[model samples]
Structures are given as structure tokens and as C-alpha cells.
Target: MGGDRDEGDSRMSNLTGLSDDLINAMNRHDLDGALRCYTEGAVYVSPVGVGEGRDEIASFLGAFLTAFPDVRWTPWSRVVVCGNVLITQWVITGTHHGPFSMPNGEIIEATGRCVNVRGCSLRTMDGDRIAVHCVFYDQLELYAQLGAELVLPRP
Candidate 1:
């Protein structure tokens, strides 16, 4: 990925191995291995917030891994690569046996309940490493599985 390609080009690239390595590292609960997949300036965006670089990403993932010690992200769909970007649909499953930190600074203690949620990750590749990683998932689904009550008006 030397230069940026036009979005209208729609030509797909093959970066499956990069994503595979990352997912496998995460499944193995290897923080260092996962971190190595990203560049030092990589940006990881999630429902929580934006992780500007490797250190921030590490902290964010550290909390998540701590909360879900046995978490695993299983691919539910084929890997899609567009130019220098990679997308993967996944089903993450784990048990809540530790404290989970929320984006808004709230901490939810372990309820001993298991969670299985469908999500996706979009990554921008910079050669052999990821320059950006964005995560998508249902926040409500996670809370509902944990038995948290929330009332909001539908517009």
C-alpha cells in the first residue's frame, strides 16, 4: 500500500494473512503478539473510544482481556479485503469473571454469565502492520446478556 487508492476504484487486495495472524494472536490471549501486528502509530477505534497508538491500544485491550480472560473471537464470515483495508465478521464469546471497564468510566463487576456477541473489525493495513483498527458491536446486547436494565425513549 504505497499510495492511497480511490474509493471508487473498488479493487480488492489480499491481506487475509494479516487479519488471520491478529485474530489468532487474540484468541491465544497473547497481548504482545497482537500488539506486534499493529504499527506504533496505529489507531484503534471502538465503542469505547479511540486508541491513538500502540500504548493506548494496549491499555484498552488490556482491560478487555482482563475482564474476559477466556475471550475468543471466532470468524463467522469470510475475510473481506478492499485495497489496503481488511474487514472480518466475528462472533466473540467469553465469560464475565472479572471487572469490565466502560467507556464512560463505569466499571461492571463479573456476573459469572457468559456472552456471545456478533461483531466486526475493520483494519487499515500499512504494509505488514495495521495502521488503524476499528471495532463494531452491539453495546446493548452485551449489557442485556449481563442483565443490566436500561430504559430509553425510541425516536
Candidate 2:
């Protein structure tokens, strides 16, 4: 998963033109381009946390782009679009090469481990811009790949 590659990130987004625009921007490592795909009041949700508004979205993306500068979310399923919702499954591949911050504000240092995490996203579109985006992924798998196991409290 850590191999030098683009994670097959060139497919058109299923949501709308905005979706494709953001994917293209991310593949090109253009944060500004990616951010332009969302509206000012967009809400980005993930298993890690929810980021409301463009500022919060940028901050959330900053963490990801910082942690995995070459990260890519490769589509693993046909995009499903109904009404204003666009859903797709993906294989998120990346290498931990910098500080990775958790949703709870815990920052993990670089481990250089590569992760091929299976995940999915549901994006709701308002007109051509994204209104809300939700992603699902396993945090435990991500942490374990970086060499840490969850310490569950015994009952």
C-alpha cells in the first residue's frame, strides 16, 4: 500500500461535477482546488469527527494531507447516487510519514507504516456543491497499522 502510486484516483465523482472536481484536486495535491468543491456551509462527517463549515473542513483536511501527503482513496465499488446522496466504497491507501492527529486531539508521530484501509463515504449534494459528506473507516485498524493497539477497559 505504501508503494509510490496515485491509488487510482482519476475516476469521475458520482455525486456531481463538484465531486469530480474535488477528487481531481486531491489527486493533484491541490488543497485549494479540493476546498473549492464545497459550499461555505458544508458539513464534513467521518468516524473520526464532524467538521462544520469550510474552515473546519480545511483544518480536518490539513491533518490528513499532513499525515499522508500521498494518500489516495481508490474507488472499490460503483458509485451509488440517489436524489442528493452519493455513496461509494473505497480502499484508502497511505503511508504515515508525519504527525497523525486523532479526533480526540491526540497526535501520533510518524511511524512510516503503510495502511490499505477499506472505507466508504456518503456525500450529500446541495446544487453542485457538497452540502454534507460522511465517511466510514476503522480507526482501530489505522492505529494498529501504525503500531498501537486499543486498550479496552475490562468489565
Candidate 3:
């Protein structure tokens, strides 16, 4: 009853704290610190691709940090948790100062464009660590902000 509710509340607090820590690490471009928030065998997925395990996850995130050296993630008003899952909406602001690789094996050289993109993530926690993290954002929004023109192939 009362005891169970207390435990549940404490668990929610811890999850929220973890989410904050992750965002802080990303804001600082602290790759190691960010990796520490996930389990050893964690899986991360985004529009770019999927990464399994710490090494793969590191590579995926490291690229973004490199491309956007001054990237910052600020929570966009809401962070909700239901059981072991945490959902967060965020805004990423940064300048393109390095190569950004595309999912289709193409690289976009630094356009020197300042980008402000809104995104969200869903994290499933296994104990204190994130076991699975999936991020959602519109690629078109990001690319348009970067001044990229979309070219359609003739079909």
C-alpha cells in the first residue's frame, strides 16, 4: 500500500535523474560519461541507424558530437515516465562544423549552418541503466535547417 507507493515514487525519481544526467553529458560532449548511463549490452536506435553494445553506441554518438561540437540538448517542456520506460522531448542546438554522415553512406560536409532541431527519445531502463533507447526526429527538418536541397530520383 503506502510502502509500495513510496518505492514506486523513488524509482520514478531515479529514472528522471538518469535522464537528466544523460542530457547533461551530451551537452558537454562527454562521450564516456554518456556511455556510462547505458548498460554494457544496451541498444540504441535513431533515424540514422541502430547500435548494439557500448562500442557501437559510442561510435554512433561520437560521430554526432564530432559533427556538432557545440551541440546542446535542452528538455522541451515534458519528460514522462511510465513504469520502466521514460519519454523525453528535447531541442538540439548546434553548428555544423564537421562532417555529418548520412544513413545512405553519404557524408555532408560542414555547411557552417546553425541548426535548431526538436526531437524525442524513449528509454527503457533495466535497473539504473538504460537497456534500450530509441530516438525520433524528422530528418527533413534537420536537413532543411542545414540548407540541404532534396533531390528525387526519376522513377
Candidate 4:
């Protein structure tokens, strides 16, 4: 029983360590370093889009790097690790200095607005690498910070 508990703790520690490595990589804007934390066929899903593999994942994350060269993710609240999954609540702070693509396939030019948005993600680890990652955030909050107004269609 003690051995089993120890094993579980060890596994959680490893996953947390891997997650820290990923955050550090992102903070450094090291795309390759961040990619190393995932498996070749890892799937990343976010409000922005879904990336099925490393190349696609690169494009998905690279877009953020391009749009906010100074983007940084800081833990906004708690980080939970259970079994092989790690959940992180984080805050991203950056300036809109480059084009940002909207979910409607529209690209908004840089408005030079500073953005601080809260988000969360759950990453499932397969062995030491993340096999699946799901991210969540408020699109309206992000857009509002970029100075986009809500426009409703006429009924």
C-alpha cells in the first residue's frame, strides 16, 4: 500500500515537472523546446484551433508568438495534478503588436493594446510527454481587450 502511494506521488511529481518545463519553454518563446514536451502525434485543442501533430501544433502556438512576441504565462491560481493529467490555471500578459486572427477567419491588425487574460488547460501525459492538451479561455475577454466591440445581428 505504501509502495503504491509512493508510485502515484512520483508520477504526479514527474508530470508537474514536465509541465513546469513546458511553461518555462513558452516563457522563453522557445517553440522547439516547448514542442519537445509533447509526443510526435500529440493533439492540442484550444478555442483558437486544433493541432493534430507537432507541425500543426507548432503553427498553432507559433501564431501566438508572432502576435505577442512578449507573451508570458504566469500561474494565475492553482495547478492540479491527478493521475496522468495536469490542470493549470494561468494568466497571459502581452501587448498586441502583430496581427491576431479571429475565429471567424478575420485578422485584426495590431491595436497596440495590452492584454491580460486568464485561461486554463488540462494536459494528459503519455509516459513523460503530453499526448493531449486542451485549453480554455474567454474569447470575448480577449477581443474586448483588443478594443473589439460586440455586434449583434438584427433579429
Candidate 5:
């Protein structure tokens, strides 16, 4: 039992390290470095949609960062690890300083809108590598604050 507990703690430490590395890579826009934190067959599911495998994940983030060059994530809480699962909470603060594409093929530039967003992620780890990551956030509030229409449903 003691050995198992030690192993779990070690795993948690590794996951925390990986999470920090990922955030650092994002801050530096080092997509390759970020990709190194995930397993080769890892999956990333963001608030927008799902991306399977490292290549797809990289491409998605690359385009996203290209559109939002100033995009940044600030972790407001420590990663909580349990067994093979890891949870992290963060606040993403960024300005619209570049082109952002709408779903209907509209491209808007530099709305100059600043966004303060609260979000969370769930990650499944295989050894020290992240195997699956899922992120959740409020897209409606983000869009509305960015000057988009408020399409919220009435209670």
C-alpha cells in the first residue's frame, strides 16, 4: 500500500510538471514543445471541438494562436490528480489583436476586446504523458463580450 501511494504521488508530480511545461510552451508559442508533453496518440477536446492525435492537436492550436497572437492562459489553481485523472482550473486572458474567423466564414480583425475567462480541463495520463485532454469554458459569454449577439435562452 505504501508503494502504491508513492507511485501515485510520483505520477502526480510528473503530471504537474507536464502541465507546467505545456503552459510554458503556450506562453512562448512553442507548439512543438507543447506537443512533446502529450502521448503520440493523445486526443485533445477543446470547447470548440475534438482533435485526435498530436498532429491534429498541433494544427488546431497553431491556427488558433496564429489568429490570436496574444493569447495567454493563466493557471489560477493547482492541478488535482487522482489515479490516472488530472484536473486543472485556469483563467484565460487575451486581447483580440488579430483575425478571428466566425463559423459562417466571416473574418474579423482586432476587435480590441479583452476576455477574462474561467475554464477547466480534465486529463487522462498514461505514465507521465497526457493521453486525453478535455477542456470546458463558456463560449457564449466569450462571444457576447467580444461584441457578438447574446443568444442565450430564457429560463
Candidate 6:
């Protein structure tokens, strides 16, 4: 039983390492590098939407990178690993000097705009690969800070 537990731990470590590598790749906008960390049938769910398979994930990231050329993520704390799951907290900082496409199909250029967003992710690993990932963040706060005019509900 001890040996089995050790093996599980080893697998968890490998998975956590893979997740770290993926984050690094994203910080660098290395699409290929990031894709390498995902399993062939990996799935990603973000506040924006869901992406199934590596190809879709690559496409989704590519579009975002194109809009935010200097996007970066700063890990705020060490990753917490458990079995095949890993949780990470991070802050993403980026400039919106280019055109951004909103989920409502509006594309607008935001010059000199900057955004600092706090986020967290839950990832499930298959061996050393990411099989599924779900990311959460405050989209409203991000947009508000980005200078979007807000309309509040009247009491």
C-alpha cells in the first residue's frame, strides 16, 4: 500500500510539473509549447467559453494573444496538488493596445489600456498531461477597468 501511494504521488508531481510548464508557455505566448502539455483530447473551460481538443484550445489562445500581445500571468501562490487534480491562483496583467472582440461580437481598439485580473484554475491531469481545465475570473471587473461604460440596475 505504501508503494501504491508513492506511485500516486509520483504521478501527481508529474502532473503538477506539466501544469507549471503550461503556465510558463502561456506567459510567453508559446502556443505550441502550451499545446504540448495537453492530452490529445484535452478540454478547456474558461469564462469566455468552452474549447474541446488541443486544436480548439490553440485557436482560442491564439486569438487572445493576437489581441493582447504582451499578456502575462503571475502566479500568486504555489500550486496545490491532489491526486490527478491541481489548483493554482494567479494574476494576469496585460495591455489592450489592440482590437478586442467582445463576447457580444463587438470589436474595438483599446489603446494604452491595461488590465490586472486575478484568477484561479482547476486542472485535471492524465498522467503528465492536462485532460481538463476550468478557469474562473472576474470578467465584469476586467471590463469595467478596461474603461467600458457600465449601466447599473435601478432600485
Task: Give per-residue lDDT, candidate 5, residue 82.
Answer: 60
Better of 5 and 6 by lDDT: 6
lDDT of 5 at 8: 75
Superior by lDDT: candidate 3 or candidate 5 = 3
lDDT of each: 0.84, 0.78, 0.91, 0.90, 0.81, 0.83
Runs of candidate 5 exceeding 4 Å displacement? 79-81, 101-109, 150-155
**For model 1, where is the 10-residue window of minimal lDDT?**
5-14
TM-score of each: 0.85, 0.83, 0.96, 0.94, 0.85, 0.86
* Candidate with best TM-score: 3
Query: Which parts of model 4 are misplaced by more than 4 Å?
Result: 78-82
What is candidate 6's CA lDDT for residue 46? 86
lDDT top scorer: 3
Model 2 segments more than 4 A misplaced: 1-16
Residue-by-residue lDDT tens digits, candidate 3, 117-137: 998999999999999999998
lDDT of 5 at 25: 95
- Stretches of candidate 3 above 4 Å error? 79-81
Question: Candidate 4, TM-score vs. the true structure?
Answer: 0.94
Q: What is the per-residue lDDT of model 6 for residues 1-155, given as tens digits with 9 covering 90 to 100?
A: 99998998777678667877988999988999999998999999986678999999997788778778899988776564668788888998898877776666666576678889898889988877889989888888788778876666799
After TM-score superposition, the amount by which residue 89's alpha carbon in candidate 3 deviates from its true location, in angstroms, is 0.5
lDDT of predicted model 3:
0.91
lDDT of 2 by residue, 4-111 (tens): 223222223335456667767877778888888888999999766889998999888887888988898777664645556777777878889889877676788989
Give, for candidate 5, the lowest lDDT window spanning 10 residues: 100-109
lDDT of 1 by residue, 60-155 (tens): 888888889999999876555556877889999999988986667678899899999988889888877899999999988998997766756799
